[model samples]
Target: MPLTRRSVMDAAAARFGWRRAYGTTTEVDALLTEQSETAYTASASHAELATAKNHDALAVQPGVLDVRGRILADVLYLEGVLTGARNRGLPSEVIERLEDVVDHGHELTVLLADAVRATAAAHTAGR
Candidate 1:
């Protein structure tokens, strides 16, 4: 199966034991769940506003909306993990890895934004 955000995050959760140093897996899970929900809500709201403002080109693209939401959620989750890892004073290597993950997540957001802009420009030009 293609890797969805949840799957990647689940793998991350299982792979990282850093959370155990500061809190139970259950606590980490709860934090992730909350962050994911918040991210999704924010993404949906932004999508709706964009659509209402005649920027529905990106929204209408196949799989783009879902990917955007997933990216937002994944970034939020990774940010939470990174924060926790720092607060717990995890080893430098682990902290570095978490930082990398967070940075990659931000990169994904930038790519998605570029896609959205390209789609919008194309749509406008075709009008």
Candidate 2:
């Protein structure tokens, strides 16, 4: 389904436990708003934002109208691992891979953040 402002705000509210003003378009606007007003905004690019923040903990597309896609993806990954382990059906290799992923979740976030920042920087530069 196409993403909508309501859906994004609802997801944010559910995940962050923030009481959203339904259909008011506040959360969606905050995330989607352009960063043209901040002083020194050009100096600090999107890459900088990604580098400064924990991207893995944050959504993959933090600037998008929908900010929950990345978090939900991580949740799904965890669920898959849990299901595999619970069934004792996880292959040794798969289990080892999962262990690595779990252990490096933070690192993965950093990596993702860097990539995002780079993409943002390119986008900003092009415009």
Candidate 3:
């Protein structure tokens, strides 16, 4: 969903009170800053990701992008303040992390599905 000012404003009003979920602009900025810093920080390990790279990342790129787009859309839908997290104000580190997610998102999706299937299989076997 394209985020318009009017739509975000309405969503913000609904998610937040006359104020916002954050008590102060400073609080919001601080949290955004922390998230940005974390996102920017280099990960020490990505072994699971290396092991999971079965398919051509290029071939799976579109679907992965779509999935990520939806996740971002969901976030915007649920929490409409891009002033801190979504826009240019966001730290470069945060942006890099988001890109990394997009890059390896298909593997993440497959991992999640496998977990779910494992749980279901376990439940059925017990039954």
Candidate 4:
């Protein structure tokens, strides 16, 4: 079937909201590059957000939205710390460790979101 207006709106809005709100495409890409394997979780979270099916799984997407928002705060804070440390010429090891912190944070948020979505989907199916 062809997509409805609301469906189209939902997909585009969900993606734009995540990128513009939690991260910018360019910034996140650069972070991942600088972070190497340390940015895996953030990269995964970004990938999950890019999936339109994930958005359509929930009616409003509030659960994932909240999870992402909360995580974004912590991730951004950690990134800031890493940036400061790097600017000060801190060791690459220390910066990588900071990126690890951000990675764990992103992992936590994505896991929570997945759990919430699973519960929500089950509830909806049971009804």
Candidate 5:
């Protein structure tokens, strides 16, 4: 269930002729940049949410952190699909199929956080 670099690299090479000696470095570089950006964005959002010192700070607003997290999750899903498809040298149609199924696992994370914050607020107010 976990991802491995070797699997990703092997899949990419098998699909796209992506050998160190033969592949286009530009595509690989671009994919890595996108992935890193998504990860950094997600981290910043989570940090803001987790570092809040009081429940009030967490309430009365939609946390930018969760929105950012969802956006980043979507980006990561896309990156994985594109990287896998590119490595396999898949056709555009096939790549589109993969993209359709890419799972962005952030909605539930955001919902859970919201639920926790709401419970905390209700408890604080003696509800």
Candidate 6:
């Protein structure tokens, strides 16, 4: 299946042991969820913009560019978090899995941005 914000986030959560606590959760898990939610929201907004019928419609939409920006920021933050975890001596295997999640998240963010740009260009040319 294609990489997506949700899938990437889920992978990250699993790697970080999200919700595995019998009665509590760790900071890493909470951080992952928070970051993932931010990305998810941005992606949803971008998807809505991608459905615009014309450049003008997309242009007039508030925060159209912000969607991509937000996702990019989230990806970067997650990468930094992973790097810190690695530095703190997380198990090599777990770190590797988290790294993969970060990589896939980055890829999805890029793909989403590209798709939105392509949609906007197509709308512009259709005018």
Worst 10 residues of 3 by lDDT: 54-63
The number of the candidate with the highest lDDT is: 1
Off by over 4 Å in 6: 1-64
Candidate 3: regions farther than 4 A off: 1-29, 33-97
Worst 10 residues of 5 by lDDT: 100-109
lDDT of each: 0.75, 0.60, 0.55, 0.71, 0.63, 0.70
Give each model a TM-score: 0.52, 0.27, 0.30, 0.44, 0.30, 0.50
User: How does model 4 score by TM-score?
Assistant: 0.44
lDDT of 2: 0.60
Instruction: At residue 40, give the lDDT of candidate 1.
Output: 90
**Model 2 misses residue 49 by how many Å?**
15
Q: How close is candidate 6 to the true structure, as a TM-score?
A: 0.50
The order by descending lDDT is 1, 4, 6, 5, 2, 3
Off by over 4 Å in 5: 1-26, 34-50, 53-61, 64-126
The residue-by-residue lDDT of candidate 3 on 11-112, one tens digit each, is 779786653355677767865776687766644344455446624334344444566566655544434433345665688776666555554654565664
Q: After superposing candidate 4, which stretches have Cα over 4 Å from the reference?
A: 1-68
lDDT of 1 by residue, 1-127 (tens): 2336545766787797432232577756766777899899878777666567654564455466578879889889989988999999999998999899889888888887787778878788888
lDDT of 6 by residue, 34-108 (tens): 779988987886756656743564553345456667878887988897999888998888788888888987887
TM-score of model 3 (CA atoms): 0.30
**Going through the candidates in order, what is the number of backbone clashes in each?**
0, 1, 1, 0, 5, 0
- lDDT tens per residue, model 4, 58-112: 5446756776887889798888988899999999997889989988998888777
Cα distance off (Å), candidate 4, residue 113:
1.2
Best by TM-score: 1
Q: What is candidate 5's lDDT per residue for 1-127, written digit by digit as tens?
A: 1236645766888798774432566756766776799899878777566567346544534554566576667767677867888799999886776565454344445565676677567667874
lDDT, model 6, position 30: 61
Whichever of 1 and 5 has more TM-score, that candidate is 1
